[model samples]
Target: MRDLYERAITAGGLHVTEGSKLWEAYREYEMAILTINDGNDEEKAKQVQRVRALFHRQLSVPLADIESTLAAYKSWEAEEGNTRDPDSQVDDVPPNVLSAYKKASEMYNARKQYEDELSVVAESEANKLQVFLKYIKFEKSFGDPARVQVLYERAVSELPVSSDLWMGYTSYLDRTLKVPAILKSVYHRATRNCTWVSDLWVHYLLSLERIRASEDELRHVFELAIQCSFPSMNEYLNIYLTRVDSLRRRMPTGLDFELIRQTFVDAAEFLSPQLGIEELLLLHAYWAKLECNIGKDIAAARGVWENALKKSGSVLEVWQHYISMEIERGHTHEARSLYKRCYSKKFAGSGSEAVCHAWIRFEREHGTLDDYDLAIKRSPLV
Candidate 1:
């Protein structure tokens, strides 16, 4: 009967890790026998062995969330004794306990020796950083949250000026610890130590978003990030995008259109110095689309495209977007006139093929057959 239950459990648990009925029944059966005839010492010892053997066997297999088995094992150890002696022979110990003991002893020895090994070879900055990274990774493998944090703290204490170390430390706190206060605290500490690293501030804002902070809170964070002197235009763009995305999702009432408009303007101003004319053209196009889509401000959208074309009239696609916007607003006549203006530019950068093709498509869609034919015939060769 035990053999039959074991076979079914093995099959059922092959793909299971938690909340398994087979696991519960097995543990309950062992517990029931162990509790009966409590006065018989030899029988009780044998019953205890049967339960211990069950845990050992269960531990040997790849069970997910071993917290249950590990906790049970610890309880059994409290009742019997801890089997964590390094020099003790494995032959006398149960198989599961032996495996756990060997792993624990190995980890203890490595941890005990790590400091001595580091103090000798950490002679240069590069070498010391490498050793610290190895130590941090080693602590992580133990899956002990406290030890991992201690190692991170130790690394940061010695290398607070190192942005890489600070970043790694904060990321561990954010991803592994997943404690909001701890994440926020470390990010604050990290930014103070490495204010020049813009990505840290970006990540801070994102973490706030993840916790579903208020718009006022997000605005405060964005303002704070802007106040940081080390941010580049690209970082500013990211901050703006994050804010816009969060607000877009919520679609809350009393949204501050003016603040968002100012963000777009500020982004263009800050980035104009770094971007070339062609890049600026695309940037304006993107901003125009944002105004159209997010703000539904058609006048503002038209203003952006007009400004872009006035500065970059030579580009074909910018003109296409401008005319498309007009057409989209039901101004087919205006779109046709804009197409004529585009052809008249005859700018050296103009690829006449795309212009003529677009013109033909526009006329065919919005004008009569006569208008379309006129477009194909009157358009110049590339």
Candidate 2:
């Protein structure tokens, strides 16, 4: 029976209050034991100590009926002849115990204010979220881990689809607790509840990587994330980026180089059709850079850029970025050839003018005086 009560009170999320029905029942059980051991002095003394201990435990917690419980404790002490003066009952308690009770009572009162506000905002999710956030802040600063967790559970239960609440809870677990199983559990639930949130998926992937989860597990999560309907194409892009980054970090020996390259290729193929020209070009640029830096395959990088140019060759941005990549890689001859190709293409509005200016600047920086003079002569403005 005692074990049952202990388990209930200390359960992962149970919040037992002082002077509640459970406390009352526990105290009555102890009193009944005292009655049963009336004739045996040793047994009676043990029961008496048990009752005293129960009272002390009850008094330590703050509850609405705490004063009544204290009064009852004092009366019991007086009847047992443990107190010299019934009127000085407060004096019978130790200074630290009394101080602890007082502090608990004050904290309870402060917490009640937040609870009241929460009750009033029950119909408004936005307001309720605010209240929960404030309440969580209070608990984090003044309460124990269990209390904070209980509050988070409550908040998420009421706002199951709220990405903000899920993010906060998962972040707290990741940052403060660092318990892998618990973090994994919470993250799993968070992603399930907030499936549309790419950030949550990204964080989940990162968390799994942090704990060294198996590759199959990480791939399962990544697949689940890509299947969700995120609000923006960039969200999809971010998820792909996080997956690639995880693979890179996990395999420093370049064992996963082909897999990483395949992921970029997959991202480009999957995202290109859904993205605007600018976004498509951005994706290609990222893929090309990855090929150059990590795969050490400049030809493959150029292939990625060539694919982008096929899709958006008229977009000056694509040509400019391709030229810039070549320049950055010290492929000066390739950059000059790209500039010549760009100038040969017929551009609308000031696109041709922009290319002319870029070519002149490039010649000045990387070409001889003859090349610079020739570029100046070829400029339409000149």
Candidate 3:
């Protein structure tokens, strides 16, 4: 039976590591075939149940079968979920030899051991900076601020410029202590050699706002962030707006908003493709948010949303807000069309399933009287 299973694995054209579930199912089917060949009905029945269970568990079932045994399981419906074609061809081996699974398992074990050994040797402060960072992350996740000080101090001393650690540490300060001086120091350290980091610059700007830094300080931070090339121009666009908004709030007549807004608009266009999908959406979203609220250019605000959607299709949050923006402008038909377009593209990946659900709820709760039907039609079950 095991020998037949080996032959069936190769015959199915499935690589062991690449399609482990399919390979396992092929092996089980081979066992079922052998039991039937030996005239053991009871054992064959058990094997059938096992094969059925395998089919139930997998989202991407293999198209072929064990030599000629493919027709026995037609009850299963295959969904094209999370499956990618193998990049390389399958390896062939003699039926008597089980080298594929053995070789792959051995290689995995060796790699795991190497990682474990390196982890053990990396127990020093410099090496375990990730651990301290992780602790800060845990605290952030739970919204707890107790160990933030300890984490921040140790992280700076051990891994001063590690952005993940520094960012995490500074975020704790922002959320818990709201200490302007600490935020300033963190920004300086975090961007010492790597200035293009948008989060670091933004946090620094925020800390400045809290501390009431002089216009000179604000402009300095702005220049430093812009010069660092750490963030795409699109990201810089939003950050620039944030600075403008803060300045306006603190001293409305002190600074020029139109000049800064123009600078950011040019920057966003220049930095469009260089940014990631999330950053790009945020850039335009913030632009639209700022402009629409301030009564600057309604057409430009709608245009910003349109450009963002074109770049990041089916980003539901953007779509929902874009829909809301259109509906607010009495463009109900446009909003309905946008909502449907977003709905059709929402099932992007399993990782974003939660985001998809949130978007559905957002649309349902905030959708206008005329748009609610289409919104509900597009929304999936939570």
Candidate 4:
């Protein structure tokens, strides 16, 4: 009964409490419903009689109190010739009822004020600071960097520490923004002080590279990023490898591949056992990329799949990527052999197994006969 009563109040967004006007009003309405439906059935009549008894037991004032209050209000109105008068005696509504009314009223007013402030902010684009903030929000939502430079130039003088503002402005400088002079400024101010926000440095580096950052600048960015705070070693590693794509032209004669190799060693050591599916797979892809780009070392590329297999032997995508890369390089034998290793491992179901079979077909279609024969030899059916 208590639970039912509580549920009723909760459903109406009211509280069951002493001196609650909402509860009192609801109780009156419920009692009136019983009064109207009292003769429906013998069972229902008894239930209504019980509800009437319970209502009076729970309520301090009787239904007559409401009637008396209403009659007094009518008499007072008749005498004063007005519905409301300061001198008229009226029953006080509960504080909870007034509080609920005030809260609803305030929420509506606050929403209006927020909308008005938003409109004023939008209209005050003549103000450079507001315009800069607008550009940051725009870039954040749409990623269109057209006005980044203009907004940055306008806002940077006043809002120097605003990272989003600076990011927008930096987006405008073209290749000039990537140079050591500019990068040094961003690193000194933003990355160094706020070591926890590693993405800021990563974004800044990418921004400069978008403007045509030199190989030296890319390397410098990586160095500084690693030196600052990398919240997760895998996160920093992925950032380093993603830039390797843009740094491809610089990798051979321009980039110090030896330095990259050392960094890879450091990252692998830090991340290998501690990695999850996404991070582990990304690490493998980075390894394949490094080998493909720098050393053209097939063994290095093969090692990525082998290491991934040791960790997550069931990940069909990892095997697929390895097979694809090998077939692309015309290493049919290696692709077949890896496929053999994958086939030996039992996956959970036929649906899971289908992906591996599809990749084998893809590899066979792309590679030589020596591959299929090797796969046949490794199979149990042979």
Candidate 5:
């Protein structure tokens, strides 16, 4: 996970100033180990020595929480007073604990910080979220999952409509904290607050699928996701397709190909006015390929292609693919007729060159001299 984060931060063009979040987190992880207590004196002493040395090693360079960490180190030495020879090795712990040292470092400061931030949130309406964000990250840095959960809950209560905060909170629980019950409750609430966002719905459904929710629960999310408020049919179609893609890839055993086909048909029908004839035709075309590739329903695939072309016959790629399917099935007569329809359409879309080339190639390989001449003569370019 550390390697993954390093790569992500480096790839993201994070400056030293921007990377304080990660440095703070790393420092917090090491600090948590300072509190562990073992039975054997030798092993216990060895462990404390190592952790203390670690603090010193990191002190050579600056960290995001250098003052807080140094203060904690000082408090630790004061607590370990007179146990070993004073002159044996490293310097003694400093005078005051960093923010009350261990107690302050662990949880005491978090409550104080939260209260402080809440007071500010109530006062500042405009750019006030940065305060709550600071509190949440501090809670997360300390390694108490329950404390983290409470902090997130309090955060979203004040800012119900912010998608980024909700996503970050839910993601922390889902991935870092690993509390399913908390995650589910939060997702349910977040969707209610953020009804108009498509990607939020996608992420919510993806979480459901990741946890392998019941088919009924999954369907419930899917139903809600399709109704999300996108500006256009094109955007709505993209969200609808994201749900279908999850079913195809993630839940294959329960994958009902018929349900998938019906979904495409209904989506096209439901939004056809905004989609227009061209977009609707394209949906049917993709559905045909899905049938051929995944459902292995060649007969239904061919049926979709033929039906779509009859209603909307002008797209060049669709015509080309239809011709290939017919010839692949040894129906040269059918292929020849489809090619004739392509010529009849006179290359209506922007892909005339590719379609004409495909026609010429088909005729040279499968057509008579007369057929070859017909293809060249009817070319739109000519």
Candidate 6:
């Protein structure tokens, strides 16, 4: 029976730690044994030593009601007819041990109010979530990492479908713990519960990449993310962007550009109905920039921009972004040509004036004096 109690205390982990009744029961059992051998002075001495040993052990652990246990131990010493203080009677006791007990008692007292509030039955899941969040915050601020993790586990178990709770837990694990296996487990569980949350899937994919998981593993998770029925086109876009970015980061020089191009194609096909002109243009811009910068394939980049123009040629922002990209890549002639094409087009937007000013600025910086003069003359016509 004593062996069973030891197992419960040691192997039960955090759940049996905070405010467990096991300590009290164990102490009572020791006292009962002492009572059974009442008149044997030698046996009584041994029992007294055993009881004191139990108190000393309990004091070292940071239990929730440590102060009460300490008081009980002192009272027991007094009842055993020890006149001196309990601390002085224990010759082998370390000074720091008592100081640590006092610190643990203070920590428990500070945590009691939050624990009390959390124990009450909440009216709704949202209220419960708020309470749990507050408790988690308090634990993070004042308690050890183990306590914080336990609080997160408790929160997620009760609010499994809460994306916010899952996100917070996974994020804390990612940022604080960085234990790959634990992170993978929590992410898998979180995604299973909140599959519709695109951000969670995105973060999961990034985490897998961060830990340098195999290419097959990363692709498998990305496929799972794509299969989720996300609420918006942007969510799908984010997943695609994250996957491509991860691929780029993993193999910056030897990346298979064809695979990336196929990803862009797949994104376009999957998101066509929901993709607005601006989103379409932004997607093409990202693809073109990757081609120009990473692949060093100017032709492929130009092809992407031309495809974007076919889709959103009338949007002034598209022209500006395309021209800006060319200028940034030192393709001055291409930028000038783009500016000319944009000026010739009769797009419906109030940004035409802004485009003309940008063109004038571009020519002043990148073009010759005669070219700058020509741009100034052509600005009003544009």
Top candidate on lDDT is 2
Per-residue alpha-carbon lDDT of model 4 for 117-171, expressed as tens digits?
Answer: 4446654534545655654455345442322333344355445556655554444
Error of 6 at 86 (Å): 13
TM-score-best of 1 and 6: 6
lDDT of 3 by residue, 159-233 (tens): 665777777666767777776765677678777845667877888787787778777888788777776664345
User: Best candidate, TM-score-wise?
Assistant: 2
Quote the positional error of residue 61 for candidate 6 in Å. 3.6
Residue 44 in model 2: lDDT: 89
Q: What is the lDDT of residue 162 in candidate 4?
A: 61
At residue 382, give the lDDT of candidate 3: 28
Estimate the TM-score of every prediction. Answer: 0.64, 0.81, 0.40, 0.50, 0.62, 0.73
| Candidate 5 collision pairs | 71-98, 74-94
The TM-score of candidate 5 is: 0.62
Q: Which ten residues in a row are the worst by lDDT in model 4?
A: 10-19
Question: Global CA lDDT of candidate 6, please?
Answer: 0.80
**lDDT (tens digit, per residue) of candidate 1 on 53-133:** 776666544344444565666666556665554233443356656586455445545664556556776667677778888
Q: List the global CA lDDT of all models.
A: 0.70, 0.83, 0.57, 0.56, 0.66, 0.80
Cα misplacement distance, residue 74 of candidate 3 (Å)? 91
lDDT of 2 by residue, 34-88 (tens): 8777578888898899888877776777555667777888888899988777776
Residues 291-362 of candidate 6: C-alpha lDDT, one tens digit per residue: 887778999889887877786777887788888888887999999998888875666776777778888999
Q: Residue 161: error of model 2 in Å?
A: 2.1
Please give the distance, in angstroms, between residue 132's alpha carbon in candidate 6 and its true position after superposition. 1.3
User: Which ranges in model 2 have alpha carbons more than 4 Å from their true place?
Assistant: 1-95, 143-145, 253-255, 369-378
Point out the higher-scoring one by TM-score: 3 or 5. Answer: 5
TM-score of 2: 0.81
Q: After superposition, how far is residue 362 of candidate 2 from its true place, in Å?
A: 1.6
**Model 4 Cα displacement at 220 (Å)?**
4.3
